[model samples]
Target: MAKAFASQGDMTDKQISFTEVGRDLYAFTAEGDPNSGVIIGDDSVMVVEAQATPRLAQKVIDCIRQVTDKPITHLALTHYHAVRVLGASAYGAGQILMSDAARGMVAERGQEDWDSEFQRFPRLFQGHESIPGLTWPTTSFTGRMSVFLGNRRVDLMQLGRAHTAGDIVIHVPDENVMFTGDIVEYHSACYCGDGYFADWGGTLDAIKSYGVDAIAPGRGDALMGQDMVNTAIENTRDFVHSTYRPAARVAARGGTLKDAWDAVRAECDPKFADYAIYEHCLPFNVARAYDEARGIAHPRIWTAERDMQMWDDLQG
Candidate 1:
């Protein structure tokens, strides 16, 4: 390999921020790392998107403790990404939730993803030794499921495919606040390695239909108010489109992967070069985009070896 993935060189810890998106609803965000959401209900609490490792999860737990002593009864995962799901043990919630498609993905490529991500970004897995194994959902749903923490209701729905085949968003009706996982990012780059580019835009539209007042996005700052929320949604749409268009154009001409890479960079770099994880995600994103453009509907599973091989090919 000519050089390590960009994430591999990111050893510095990010500053954590626990921002309140609504009453009793919080977003746990790092500088640009994976984020978690907290919803404190009448009696218990529900957490969204566990961090990468048990140690990382503890930080979100600590933030939750400061606000409420209520036990976390539900842990909802939006998808099956290793970085978001491997920390399940830390929550120790009796009921863990994921979409049926997400659970299926876990069975298909969970271990491979864990190995690939662990190798790509060691910093995210600060306590990799403590991870029990691949996180499994005790309960799985097909489209939408509603869980009530006493009186407050948290609706988990699979809007459409975006970041992954089974991406769900947690919506709180009373507050009109939604916890969108990697489906909608604020300032950070969307990791589209396992994404469905063709269906992503429709999924974004589904999320936009709600017109929620506040959104605890997958990364970056907590979006509060309609203006900020709309801005993030559109920016995310732009990022996804910018990345796919050029790659698709290259693929349409039966161009090489390297050709698609250059075209994508030419389009995306000017706007997203400074975005967090932009470099780390570009090659994988381009490869996936190229594949999707060439008629691959399902994303190819990413393994540790494949990560290196793809990186080498792109670098060459």
Candidate 2:
């Protein structure tokens, strides 16, 4: 049967949870929805990954208020995806931090992504009107930058491109806690519409090298303990391989995009069928994999029109 268009069929509210993963570090997750990570510094606060809208971000702010009254001084955009970065204005942060590459993406296709994602996932874009155009990064860095929140140090590093060319992770060295945006999804599907599948595994390996004690993934629950962290990383890596390997093989034989999609579904469905967003992401994931496997270096822009076209061609 043909599936629902993007996340358009998903309108029910998810249960939100705010769990403290470490000292002054909390994870704000909404079931399978986008997540935000909180870091309470000695004096101020930093938020990682704003939700889809100012209204949704306000819900996160309420959760942050429940924990501490510290002013949110820093807002980090782990990547340029609309669901992750559009709600940035609500934070009222002094510095909006992102990688220089992410800034370039925002300049290149931010508007297209905003429209595509809003149409694709209307439920997440609850307060679409509240967004003040594109959320530009006030401060962007190349390689790595250290943000100090009083005595605490938050390291923002661009290890390697995975979900997007500009993905970065928020690392708290003292606590061995890392908030890996969409680069590392725990019990959730990796939306590879803008991903580099060939490099994603190595990126996962790079993340594993950190020996993280706790991880606040982009979606689902926060991962705690070394075993769980390792499992999450491995699971993500497996998911990447499961999606790309079949598509790559099919593409190698000059197969159609539908063939690649079917191969990926056959390989992944048995293992990841129950994962959140698996159905929503499958087509986009296979298309990108097919492109990368056939040597498309960069992802094509995903406009709303293209989104429906792909869905009709593949999912239908």
Candidate 3:
């Protein structure tokens, strides 16, 4: 059994479920904040995603300590997000793994992303000083990598470009559970500033092709059964379509950004009123969807200054 160290925050949401999905696979979730996957092998452990800071990750690490003494040998990054990867040192894993696209993004706009995400959610970055620097994987794979953890088999695959140009999923064969990074969010608002709405939907379909029984999505509680998993996927799909459709329509009509934003808000806000970070993500999501519909395949990088400018323009 694993135990978690709890923390307090404005969200007032606290959850530490050490549910065993398979024989040795477990999920450590904190409500819908940021969930991490734990793969315990006979000799070592591979923590799928390290939280924002070591201090925050320690809570998850403390829980892992209760179950096994096997050193955390590997840390896998699903993508390049300050809230997700900056806390790499805490785990102190022997190796940090990511996809080649992730590394390229780090080399390109890691700092800007750090600033953007920090501005979006300050609570996730509790210990600002602890971040030694941008997190980089020691080893990076181009598309996929298959690894065996004792008797457990993990198939890491990058099916398409959704969350980012380079996104990966950790698939556990025995458990039939897929640990989707930000590629598939449960109830939380899917941040689309750097996302491809159409491609994101296609990626969701790609994920379903694996025939997963459960999914530990990027945010929100883990999907338990295939039905719940399908619901999550469907919700994500519907949200993406709802957001992009109006943005596309407004752009085609040569409306201002505010007009485009208004169009989507009327459609999405009511439906996704209770979803996580809906307000925080709405402006950025609308901005990006507007551009994507205008034929911008890659999203413009977000810097601190650019973020403020966009926020002022859209939010104000």
Candidate 4:
């Protein structure tokens, strides 16, 4: 069997791919690891997600410097994942933005999450000491917010909850491009440790409704054309369904948590086994799916202790 925390063993460096998905829209992808989006506006720049630490984020800064000298005035978080938001301080952004719901999540369990994530994925948090602390958003919006980089307008919208209750997407209407956080993972395993499976499907539909031509997902490669964008969405939707269906079936049949987990693996592994974080995410994903299948509305906070308990009970 794989190690309890599979990602703890992942330390090989991944080649980063920084590609321009649209006119001024860029995606910084590192193999199948967490991805960040870059938007160069009329005069300033906006970074969609911050990497794991200040040190890790500096690599992104170096990449940005290669293209534009514009100041990174804004850092917008898609959600409250440690690898995604903890690097906010590195940007030195004038404003760090997130949905109001995301900010609330930070207040509720941000510290616990930071501890849990740092333990779960050590490779991503290489420069752990550099994280000054939890990243709290300077500006938060309830529904929608618009930011202007000179004449360019970027819309930040909280369409619906998927990976987390506060997940948001950045839309560039003029370029027909979008930066979806973990809300849309291209070929990566959807880390549903705190996800809402049913709602996530609806959220995917809402993302499609935008009719975006290019998309920068939270993980995997960037989708450049309409066809590839649609495929990524469809594949993500399929992964969600494949994971939840068997687990829900097991739950409905009064099966044990292990039973539900095994059922999910049996159903989903064939298709998603090669995806990034597949093994590392399965236990937590199945646990959450089991809860949601049994009608748990809000996801429970995952502390480092609780994470280990779940891992032992399920994966052990």
How do the residues 1-316 of candidate 2 rate in per-residue lDDT, one tens digit apiece?
Answer: 3766757898999999999999999999988899999999999999999898999999999999998999999999899999999898899999999999999999999999999998888999997998988989999999999999999999999999999999999999989999999998888999999999988989998999989899999998999999999998999999999999999999999999999988999999999999998988998999899999999999999998898889888965
lDDT, candidate 4, 1-316, per-residue tens: 3345888788888999999998888999997788999999999999999998998899899999999999999999999989998988889999999999999999999999999999898989978898999999999998899999988899999999899999999999889999999888877999998999989989999999988999999999999888998899999999888888998999898998999888998999889999988988888999999999999988999999998888888855
Model 1: weakest 10-residue lDDT segment is 49-58
Expressed as tens digits, the lDDT of each residue in 1-316 for candidate 3 is: 0211111124454667766666677777776687788888778898888988888889779989988899998888898888789888999898898999999999999999988777667778878788899899888998799877788777888888887887899998887888998888888878777888888888999998877888888888778888888999989999999999999999998887888899999999889978877777787889899998888889899887776677667655
Question: Each model's TM-score, in the order given?
Answer: 0.99, 0.98, 0.94, 0.98
Better of 1 and 3 by TM-score: 1
Q: How high is the lDDT of residue 24 in model 2?
A: 96
Q: Ranking under lDDT, best-scoring first? A: 1, 2, 4, 3
Off by over 4 Å in 2: 1-3
What are the per-model numbers of colliding residue pairs?
A: 0, 0, 0, 0
lDDT of 1 at 183: 92
Count of clashing pairs, candidate 2:
0
lDDT of 2: 0.93
Question: Which model is ahead, 1 or 2, in terms of lDDT?
Answer: 1
Q: What is the lDDT of candidate 3?
A: 0.83
Candidates 2 and 3: which is better by lDDT? 2
> What local lDDT does model 4 show for residue 265?
88
Give the runs in model 1 whose Cα sits over 4 Å from its true position. Answer: none
